[model samples]
Target: MELNDKIEKALHAEQKDHEISAGWRLILASALGIGFGSVGFATYAIGAFIDPLGKEFGWSRAEVQGAIAFGVGLGGFAAPIIGMLIDRYGGRSIAIYGLLGVTVGYLMASTAGGNLCYFYLAYAAVAVLGAGSGPVSWTRAVAARFDRRRGLALALTLSGTGMAAIVVPPYAVLLVENFGWRVGYVGLACLPLFALPFVLLFFFPAKSGPAAAAAAPVSTDAASAPPTGLTLKQATSSYRFWLLLFSILAMYLGITGIVPNLIPALTDKGFTPSAAAAVQSVYGFSLIVARLGIGWLLDRFWGPAVAALVLTSPVMACLILIGEPNYATAIIASALIGAAAGAELDLLAFFTARYFGIRNYGRIYGFLYTGVAFGAGLGPVAFAYLSDLTGSYNASFQGALVLFALGGTSILFLGRYPNLSAETRPANH
Candidate 1:
């Protein structure tokens, strides 16, 4: 009845929640990881097939590329709405259903009737699944299950994307070369089916210990001090929110936005496709290295410190890119940029939870993911446009260098507020 009693009850609920099994957490995290990884493949794979697809369908380059952009925009449009729903309903339910949608979308895309409109339809459906089933959903799921090792947990979950980058592109290239792009897409459809059994039926149990007990109703004013959750309005008003937004924008704009174009950019600069693909492989390799390294740093240091370290990759990459367009330099630059991107994405989700409590994590993470979408989605088109205007890939890349630098500088400004309040901080043995 009293406020103190309510605080005690809330604490009790948290303690009970921690009783969840580690095995359960790992299974859910891995399943969500694979699902999110597939999203990366879906978004970037089209670029590799652009000329081929256009040739087969008799569509112009801009028209086919426009369809890819449309899918990205549609995904961004759907993110906030999906976030709101996840905040209202649990992420498990949404993730399970969205994976099914992804399967259907991929199957349709793989078998698209040589028409530009068919590609648009398949991609639009893929966009819907992406908003509901990607990092935002996975991060929310991790947030619900763990409180003490939250950073490590989040980093592990997001490492899926980096892994996908390392693994998927080469496999896609092989599939497209040997069989055709269509078969490569069919392979993607199988990813969601694999994820579904683990997440829907195996890993995601209905309720953890405390969530079940806390189901009883209590008077709102008496049960919580300010209340148990954050709303979108309250989140947008916070300073950290905007800082995170710009940080993600800069990372995406300078790094991931350019990643899918790395091979083509090298080819334009006089390297053969084989040479360019080799350079791209270095980029993919660094993503895995960065994820493992940053995951360790995130668990041991302040969020900003880890972020600053990760941000260095883009700045370094830009310097190399601007100095020379040769194969060696491009390889180094591409790897650096790729590593930074892989690490930054994981850090963004980890920091979002560290800085903001996980009470309304889905909604907050959704908004942040939107900022990421804007940067990554528009990045390639913008780079190409700038190249068209300047008549050089160097000029466009130089612009990206500036953006990466600006983003790196901003991370140094994250003030040293402790990650958790004394009451929320972990208890010593």
Candidate 2:
């Protein structure tokens, strides 16, 4: 047998006894879906009560929005550290603990009586929990488990965010309208607590099958690196790390920050609140459609081919917005934007694995998540501030269009790099 053939056999032997078991994938997906769905309810649903909270508490808009910033800021601090922990320990323990934090935060929030500190505490607590339960935990786990279908698994795991976006808003609206904000908060608080019991029951490493099983040490030769992970310091030192960082910043900057702000921007363009909301729903629904569609494509196409297709979506959305058409135009834009948002999360995870080895994935992914936090945290507030300055949504929307196009252009370069799985480095040497 040729030397390369021997290398292939050794790697194949690593997979002889274990593989990512289907049952485990289902459990992880369910845990992610529920945990993410609950957090989604807690985060996005708060908008429904913004007016009511302000009216009752007499707080200014800045003060109210400040609570959101506090939460995001706290997340920025917790996520990277948690990632390091996940790299050192494992994902299951952190996920369970994080869910418990969210439950406690929301429970405290349910009893809050107009005290700003109380609201801040609740939001901050949830932020800490977010580090453990969000994409950083589950997506990394899925990526580590599946190689050929890694992209699809990531898409499935992250589809949780879309699921939350789809279900939470309306549920929150109904809760606030019928039962009152206090009752709504209590219900939301209970969701994380409820999720905790199930995660403890089914989310286990043994369930992940072979991928989670301990492997022998990697050899020094070209053929040796195992599919699992590395220490945090070793991960950061690689050239692949920088590539992943730039890729994330290029793609994530506009998408995470701009899409949420689209809700208010559409309303500003003469659409009624209900019509604007419907448009938002269209965008959220697109995520569900796009993720499934992209997952299918990832299994068959090269990563960049699928990536380019996904990147085009935001450009289409921006074009629709610039056209300044009627409600139908707005809805179309929303759908495209939704698709782009849906695909980015999975693609980012794919990019990380495609560019970097899966060993040390948690820390590397956590660092990447920090960039996501920066984009998500700053995007809406920056857009809102720009709207105030420009006195129009069109100008702000146009700015987003430029950024979206730039992100699309970046994906074209991805095809030029050597496949990380092959153990060859990019020519940037």
Candidate 3:
């Protein structure tokens, strides 16, 4: 406790001396840690495994993608439990467990022997802890610490995934090219280990900051402040919650369903595999800009409006998909897709905190992210399944247009956001 005070005091002194707040640095560290692990291992790297897994097992695309659906969907269902754990406990233990679990999953995947079930179980180990070390766990600590700039803080945290997308996919491709898919999985397994120390030391701060705890008020101020939003239960009961949930679900389904197939899709369009990876790298750049830009917008304007506007990128990408895209069209289309994909969680987390307030944040956000997970699981399979059935990606891309529009349009109905009071929210929290 005394050590925490000293660190906390020094952090204050640093901020007082006109350096960046230690909280902001911690938020950046959290983003980097999550980007290094979750983004590298789960999101971007998985695409590289699709061909190798299929070639080894003689499985269909949908069959291979089943791992993404089952693992990510199951992880979403597990989120409420993880969120409760976050509320009761700080995110430190959950983050640790998540890293360990993902590592184990990747290790087990590295040992796959052409068995579909083996791959499923391994990826399940990784996704089951989705919320633990992900935005769900990391954002709470950030949210607790920042109010005024919370939108940007959450954006920065989620940008770690963007950074991961930028580097991990191409790097995974390099590993696969040089060593093989098994070795690539093993390499990914080791990524979280490198980030673990940063997470423990900086990402997860003391549960309640010394400054916040000191100024926290008792029950007498409850009526005066009047809580801004609902608990998890109330959130679930409202149309507002359902609107947000389904919107996220629809958007993410369109995203994850197609993302793992990006290289293949591009390669089919006449780009070489290396060129495909470069295109994806460009996508990553666009995703990073969109995430940070959306973050900046949320702090200033209505988030749903920003979401609705950005969500159109996917719609435009889908229209481009209807055509036989050339080099320029493919890259432009990809950048739009990346923009839509990147803005998702930033909007979800930001909207959750804004609409619901901080009281039941962990649990409410957890429930909402289940939509994200469920959509993630549903997407790739649906995409692959549609491709297999239709014998072309044109149908799948056309279908994505509907999903994107639906999600973007749905957010318009969340009603007005209520403002919370500082009395209920302690500063330096």
Candidate 4:
């Protein structure tokens, strides 16, 4: 009987290992979905489109950039509602519909015939309809799947944006150059369609099998069950929530504002357009490195400290660009900015899980993501407006310096992570 028990235990352990290995499919699917989703393709590709659309429509830089601000800002209002749906219904179906909506949105955008209002309306449709394909759903799925390596897993998932950053700039430039901006929009629309199949196949949670058993949290106790943290109201009421919101707003206002403008800024400094795009590719590579590196650091070190260090690197980037930088210097600055941009989403996802817990993750992350969307939308417009006003990007870079400092400092006060599991909660009244 003892020998039989040992053999059974050995087989069970082997089976558990196999089950854990299967979870990588979930990670890969989530990464692909995120890379091609609205946050990935739409946000990163906007920079390449900015000059073409502006020249074509005879619009100013600010006017050209405002489309994203108008779209993502207004669309962000839908995040909490989407979050509620995800928490109740799960992410897979929502992601499928959202990707399809993005495809249609891109087609609509492609049909714009130089009417500025029409362009804005098309982007607005993309934001409103495609909100489900954003980080809110993808991060929720990833956060639910991994606990021990949650930070790194979230990093890898969000690295899809990094991949988009690398591919979209050059690709967008190529399309706009070869086929015109209209065709460029048509090509961009195909990305989410590519991601849809992956999400359908792997984003779903396993049920009634060894895979399900492996996917389950290692701890099977009541404390380790799903929905293990503060409610949305409770999270909102906490001081940390407000602080995090402010940090996100400031960091994105600086980072996202600068990214879409980097190519233009480089071109202004005497680099050719293709050379500028190459620098953007370098920035994208930095994004991938930052996501993986900062993610690993978050798991081993205090998260806020890691965030503070990474977020502040962009201050140096701003300083570098404030002067007339050499091509190599410009590349370094772009890389620094990309590192901060890469770290921002990873920190937001990891912090949401660590500080707020996963009980209300969908809703909580959705509310926080509203800040991300708004900041992203507004940043480019703000940067362009500043450039338009001053006739130089230096003033905008100076403002970013301040924003990055303030944003980095705020997170340091997040203090330690709280234990908000159901078992740890105190009964009220």
TM per model?
A: 0.82, 0.80, 0.88, 0.91
Q: Model 2 reaches what TM-score against the true structure? A: 0.80
Candidate 1 deviant stretches above 4 angstroms: 1-38, 57-62, 205-213, 216-230, 323-328, 388-392, 418-429
Q: What are the per-residue Cα lDDT tens digits for candidate 3 across 1-429? A: 999999988865554333225466777767866676443337567777777777877988888788888788778877878877776667788887787777888888899897889888887888775447766787777766666567777788888887877888898899998899999989888888877887767765545333434445554433223233456786788787888888999998888766777777776667777788777777778888998899888878988788888886788888987788887887898889889877898888888878777667788998888898888888888888887888777888888899999988888778778765555553333
Misplaced by over 4 Å in model 2 are 1-43, 58-63, 112-117, 206-240, 269-275, 322-325, 389-392, 415-429
lDDT per residue (tens digit) for residues 1-429 in model 2: 699999988876564223335545544554354335323444455555555577889864345555656776678667778767766577788787777777777777778897989888887887876558766677666766566555566676677767666765566557866888788777777666656666777665322212433343344432223454444576677765655566556555566445555545665677754555566667668887898788768767776767767776677677777666588888788778778877777777777766655665666777877766666665555555666677655665666777667665566566543444533321111
Q: Give the local distance difference test score of model 2.
A: 0.63
* lDDT over C-alpha atoms for residue 231 of model 4: 75
* Candidate topping lDDT: 4
In model 3, state the lDDT of residue 135.
Answer: 68
Candidate 4: 10-residue stretch with minimal lDDT:
205-214
Candidate with more favorable, higher lDDT: 2 or 4:
4
Residue 57 in candidate 1, Cα distance off native in Å: 4.1
Selected candidate, larger lDDT, 1 vs 2: 1
